[model samples]
Target: MSATQMDMLWMAYGKAGAVGSIRHEDDLFHVVMSDRREIGAYPTLEIAKGALISHLKPGTDRPEFRRV
Candidate 1:
């Protein structure tokens, strides 16, 4: 998938107020974010994206997805 698609997925699963960015280390793209005042680092973009979505509360506003 495209980088933008991956970013969107990551944002969807991230916690409230979380922000994500792509960082390169050792020739790999890492997805990292802040969660509850702690930093969460994911080895794979897919995992990071999943974590964000899985923890979301019901009826949460997803403005990024236009579901607000």
Candidate 2:
């Protein structure tokens, strides 16, 4: 499917923790958790995505990223 500009960025909850998404809003991007908590604001979506992945474990319960 074609990616839309209005896509909602969010993360999936795993056994260890929830890997939230890098939200693009207000002309800015941020890595937010599922608990409605903002980790930090990143300049680009790549940066934010990298940050989230860094927090995830490399085991079976890996964090799932969603933008649909």
Q: Using lDDT as the measure, which candidate wins?
A: 2
lDDT tens readout by residue for model 2, 1-68: 23454445666556666656676765557787666667787777777777766665565455656664
- Regions of model 2 farther than 4 Å from truth: 1-7, 12-18, 57-62
lDDT, candidate 2, at 22: 72
What is the per-residue lDDT of model 1 for residues 1-68, given as tens digits with 9 covering 90 to 100? 55544433323323455444434344344444434422345676555455544445676554232111
Q: For residue 37, what is the lDDT in candidate 1?
A: 28
**lDDT score, candidate 1:** 0.43
lDDT of all predictions: 0.43, 0.65
Model 2 TM-score, all chains together? 0.55
How many clashes in candidate 1? 3
